[model samples]
Target: MLHQQVFKLALLSNALLLSIGILQNPSLVQATPSYKASNSGVPTQSARLNDTLIIPGLRFGPITRTTTYQDLVKMFGASRLSDHDVFGAEGLSRLPGTKVNLGETRSFLVAWTNNSRTEVAEVRTTGSAWKTQQGIGVGTTLTELQRILGEFEIPGFGWDYGDVVRPKQGRKFKYNIPILYLSIDLKAAKRYPSDYRAVQGETTILSSDAHLKHLGIKVGEVRVYFDQPGMTSAE
Candidate 1:
């Protein structure tokens, strides 16, 4: 009987010791798993969508008037951005710029104010992905533009500054102006000899011109310029 009592006391002591140890170190107990998500350093889908947005006179995705070449490298990585000479407006001369996405369908150009490339002068995209708030993008037809812009003018085709959309005087736009410029090119211009002849050259063609409606002219490029005072476009 005494041996049995001693054995019972030993068992109780062991249980008490275990309880004491657990009390002293509460971490000994299993804790509820906390599932914390970590970022893999890749941009999220929403972030990429924001980057593709073309906010006129303000931002092109993450790029702004103050965005630098180094900023481009950081945002898109050096592999996606490459040095290239982009043709200036009016085809005056080639200016230093960075080509984004290289040969991809999402390819775009960022022209700098100078060789320093410290400031963004313009952001041009032929890619259909970059679009304004009004859904006007590279592939938007001339008729669609007229419907949206409300009586805009188109420069004649077959020249350096040809096919550019110029807003008419006293015309009000749904959005702000002097920032977004669209270049409309008619790929089938050659097919319509009479229509092409009527609109080709350095003349200004009204958006409502009967010849232009059937020509199937579409916006080939979207250029966003930063040229206001205290802005980046100046030399």
Candidate 2:
């Protein structure tokens, strides 16, 4: 009986020691949450546009405005991409569109310069997950955008009748580029009569075209672009 009790005590002590060992293990104690992002305030790979800050001249998620196309490939792993030259600059500028996970954002466009593969000129995205620090995202309402971004202007033509807001601070004159593009869905315009009227008042085309007048209004997509050295007005 004594031997059996001693064996039982020894087994219990070993079990306790093993539990203590596990509790003291630094790896186990320091284990991080899988969902947390490496950079605080920076969004995770799966974070939505409004969930992260849109720091112009800085970065978006894992991609910085200055991050090169080659660097992107190295960071995100191999991705199928298409490359082209800037519309007017030709050889001077290279634009590469990559198919990578942009959370809820729809597109990822990067531009490089100096005829180099690693020179990143700009980064643009229409991802819904991409947003300004003010929480204005791709799907944010026009009223909300106007409220946060103040007055904005809409290009009279093009497939995107989105309004552009140039922020006065946080990356202003450093890059003479559109900070945020707020657009509405023409198809959904009829549903939002007030927004439809707002769009009509902003652009003459919508008001002039009787058929297009019926278009609806819902925040369409948002695009954020960085300014590079050689880019001209045509780009």
Candidate 3:
């Protein structure tokens, strides 16, 4: 048992070393590897959030919950997806729901559990206005996001949409919540199959301290998605 643990530690250390090397080089993480980006916020495998996806400048204005492709064309002027297969992906779908301020909300997100290859995605099924904590214009609709992102997907556990809330300083809802994901499923040859489940009663953490007022949860609500990874990168 002791030898097994030592071997595991060694393997972990090697992985950490590899990741550090990749980060320091920066070139290895560049989108297109040898090409510059065509637009802003459209991250390739190389482009990563310097801070976090939840960074302050990343929020947009909120529109009605029922957004569509025409809204994206009007706002972005062109489409980046340029493909049909991406639309069929489960990672690209979000249920219809309005963005609201839950008022000092506290919640947690679980991406993977017990070595489960779970991931999260931000999908907008309709064209809606999204907002930030400061209530600035982020963008309108999912296609708008698609133009900015090109095409990509992340394996996730589930989402935390309804748990979001507005600030005490604002009277109306100021934040537009993008769909949150906890787990993701993938599709197979002619069919969608495969799933990743979250660790039951697993520990969780939050970036907000004032919202919790002092309590951090060791477990949280779990959601599931189906049909991811089963498809190749959009082409």
lDDT of each: 0.61, 0.43, 0.24
Task: Provide the RMSD of all predictions against the true structure, rounded to 1 decimal.
Answer: 27.9, 23.4, 21.1
Error of 3 at 97 (Å): 17
Q: lDDT tens digits, residues 1-235, model 1?
A: 4433543353344334334443554432222122221263333434543456565455666667787887666566788878888885456677799998845447889988899998888888878877665677788877787777778766577765556665554333444322333443446666767887898776777889888766777777777765431111110
Question: Lowest-scoring 10 consecutive residues by lDDT in candidate 1?
Answer: 226-235
Better structure of 1 and 3 per lDDT = 1
TM-score of 1: 0.70
Question: What would the per-residue lDDT of candidate 3 be over residues 179-234, giving only the tens digit for each residue?
Answer: 32222112321132121222112223222322221222111211211211111111
Q: Candidate 1, after superposition: displacement of residue 109 in Å?
A: 0.6
Model 2, residue 38: C-alpha shift (Å): 12
Q: Pick by lDDT: which candidate is best?
A: 1
lDDT of 2 by residue, 1-235 (tens): 4433543353344334333443444342233223344344433445422234444343454555555655555544455355655432114334544445544554566656555655555555566666544576566765565465443334332322224443222121222122454455655665755545654432333223343334432245443343421110110
lDDT of 1: 0.61
Off by over 4 Å in 2: 1-52, 80-107, 157-163, 166-178, 189-221, 228-235
Give lDDT for model 3. 0.24
